[model samples]
Target: MKQLFSPRADRLLRGFGIIGAAALVLAATVGFALSRSDGTWGVGTPAAQPIPFSHAIHAGQIGLDCRYCHAGVEQAADAGMPTAETCLGCHSQVWNVSAQFAPLQTALALGRPVTWSSVHRLPEHVRFQHAAHIGAGVTCAQCHGPVETMARTVKTETQSMGWCLDCHREATPQSASLVAASHAQFGVEVPPLANCSTCHR
Candidate 1:
C-alpha cells in the first residue's frame, strides 16, 4: 500500500476544527450577553402613547393611587386600562376646554377606548397576575419602578425571566405561595415560587 496521506495534513485539520469550535463558543457567549442587555429589552425607554398622560402629575403631585386608572389591578389578571370616561371624569372639570382633551372627548363620544401603548410587557408564555402580586403585598413601584415620578412611562426593569426569578427567590415565605392554591389540581406538591408551572401556565 502507498502512503497516500501526510502527517502535516492531519495536524492542520485538527487545528482548524479546534479553532472553529472555539469561535462558535465565543459567538454563543456574546449573543447570550447581548440578549440579556437592557437595550435589547427596551428598559428605561418610554413607549409613545396616543395621549401624553403624565403619571408624575397625576400620581405624584395629585396623589392618585395606581388603582385609579388601572382599576382591575387588585382583582383581575390584567391591570385594566382606564376608559376615556375615566379620564373625562376629572378632565371634564379641569382641562375640558384644552386642545389636549380633544382626543379624549372624541373617544368618549364615539364610545371607543383610547388605545394606549404598553410600557412593560411580558411574553405570552408568562402568566402574570397583577391581583396576585398586589395581594401578596408587592407594590406597583416594585416591578414598575418609581412610576409616580415619571412624566412619560418607561420600562424601568427588564422584566426578564431571571429578573422575575430573582424576586421570587427573595420573596417572603408568606408571599411565596403565589399560585400554590391554583396548582393543587396537579396532585403533586409544587414548589410555589421557582417552579416553571407557576409562571409558565
Candidate 2:
C-alpha cells in the first residue's frame, strides 16, 4: 500500500506539533507567573471573611489581646481559631442583630464555626510551630506585622524560607528567649535557626 502522508509532510507535522506545544507551555508559564505576582495572590492579599470581622475595631479599639482569640498559640503547634462560643461571648451582647453578623449568628446557632479564610498561608511542604515561636518570645507582630491596625486580615510579610532564614540569622529581640529555649531544647548543639532542617521539617 502507498504511504498516506509523505515523509516531508510527516516531519512538518511533527515540527508543528512540537512548536505548538512549546508555545502553549510558554503561555501557561507566563499565566502562572502573572497569577502569583499579580494583586490576586502573595503578601498583602486581604482575605474576605464570612463576616466583616475587623481586627482594628476588636483589637485596636476594644484592646482585646491576641491571646483572647488565639487561645492556643502558646500551647499548640497550630494557633487555633476562635471558637463559636468565643465570638458569641461578645457578639451576643453587642451587635447581635447586625446584618453583617447574620452569618456569625447562623454559624453559632448551627454549632459550627465561621470558616474564615486564611490570610497568612505557607506552602503545604513547610511546617510552622506556633508554640515554639511563642516560647521564643517572637511576638506575633514580628512576622504578622501590626495586625491590630488591619481592618481586614492581610498577609503583610512574605512567608518564604529565605525571608524566614534572614530573620533567624539576625540578632532579634527574641534572641535571649530563643537561646534559652535552645538550651532547654538542644542541650548543647546550638544549631543555627537558619538551617534548612530548622524550618523545612
Candidate 3:
C-alpha cells in the first residue's frame, strides 16, 4: 500500500506511449510508400467472384486453352468474357438435364450474357494489359494463381502494383525474347513487347 498506484500508473503510461509511437511510425511508412510513383502500399484485399466457375474442370481436365473462353486475350487489351455460345458448347449437351444448367440454358437460348462478376479488378486509373503480360511469357498462373486446380475460382494474389512490378522485372527479358522465339510455344505468331503505350494507356 506504500506506493501501489505510483509505479503501476507510470508503467501503464509508458506502455501506452510506446504503442502510440509505434502506430505512428507504421502509418508514416505506409503513407510514404504509397505516395511514391508505384502507388503500392497498404495492399488491398482480393475480391470474390459471383459464379464459382472451376478452372480445374475447364483448363486441366478438358485441356481447354485460356483463349477459348477469354477469346480476346491475345488480340485485345482486355480478355473478353465467354459468350453464351461458349458455355452452350459443353452445357447444352451434358449438363442440359441438370437443374444447375437451367439458368445457363435459358441465358444461352435467349442470347443473354452471363452475369459473371469479375474477381480481379484494379482501380480505374490503374492500367493493366493482358496481351502484354501474356506475350511476356508470364503464365496465367503467375497472376491468377494455379487456376487449373481451383474448383471454384478464388482470387489467390493480392494483385498489388508491387506484385505486378516484381513479375515485370523478372519477366522483362523473357518477354522480349519470347517475341523473338518461334511461335510454336504459344501456337500463334508471337507479338512484340516494345510498346509502352500497349500497357500504360
Candidate 4:
C-alpha cells in the first residue's frame, strides 16, 4: 500500500533461488565424483602384509595359480586367505633361515593365523561370492587386476557398486553362463543386475 516493496524484489528473489539451486547441484555433482574417484577408495595403493610376499614371484614369474593359496575361491563366498602353513610349505625349504620368514614361523609355532592386510574389500553389506564369478570364468585378474605383475598386492579396480553393476549389465555370453551356474550351484534364480538383492543381502 505504501510502495514498501521494490518492483525488482521478486526478480532478485527468483534469481537468488536459481543460483542457489545451481550451486547445490554443482556441489552434489563434485561430491559424487570425488567419492567415486580412486583416491577416495585407495585404489592402486598397495597394502603391506606382515611378510613381504611377492605375488610377482609367485603368480607371475613362478606361475602359481591363485587357487593355490586362495583355496576356497571356487566353493565359497570368500577367497580364503593363505595360511601360515601354506607359506611355510615352500618357504620352509626355500628361505627357512631368512629373517623374513620369521612371522610365518611364529604363526605356525603359535598355531595362530597371520593377519594379512586386505587390499580389496567390499563393504560389509555387499556379499560377493568368488565361486560364482569363478564358475562364470571370471579370472582373478579381471577383478584383482594383474596381481602377477604386482610385487605387493593393491586394489586396482574400484569394486564399487556402480562398477560392479556396470560389469553385470555388460556381461555377454558369460551372463547366461553365470545364471546357469548360479542355478546349478546355489539353486537360486539369478536376479536382474539392477536388483537391490543381487549384491546386497
TM-scores vs. true structure, each candidate: 0.76, 0.67, 0.62, 0.76
Worst 10 residues of 4 by lDDT: 177-186
lDDT scores of the candidates, listed in order: 0.83, 0.77, 0.66, 0.80
Minimal lDDT window, size 10, model 2: 177-186
The TM-score of predicted model 3 comes to 0.62
Q: Write the per-residue lDDT of candidate 2 for residues 98-167, one digit (tens) a residue.
A: 7776777777779887788897777887878898788877889988889999998887676766577777
Residue 115, model 1: lDDT of 76
Residue 164 displacement in candidate 2 (angstroms): 0.6
Score candidate 3 by lDDT. 0.66
Per-model clash counts, in order, read 0, 0, 0, 0
Any residue pairs clashing in model 1, and if so which?
none
Q: Candidate 3: where are CA atoms >4 Å away? A: 1-52, 169-201
Model 4: lDDT equals 0.80
Q: Residue 194 in candidate 4 has what lDDT?
A: 44
Total clashes, candidate 3? 0
Per residue, candidate 3 scores C-alpha lDDT tens digits across 56-155 of 9999899899889998887677899887678777776766566665656666678788777766768786677788667756678777777778786666
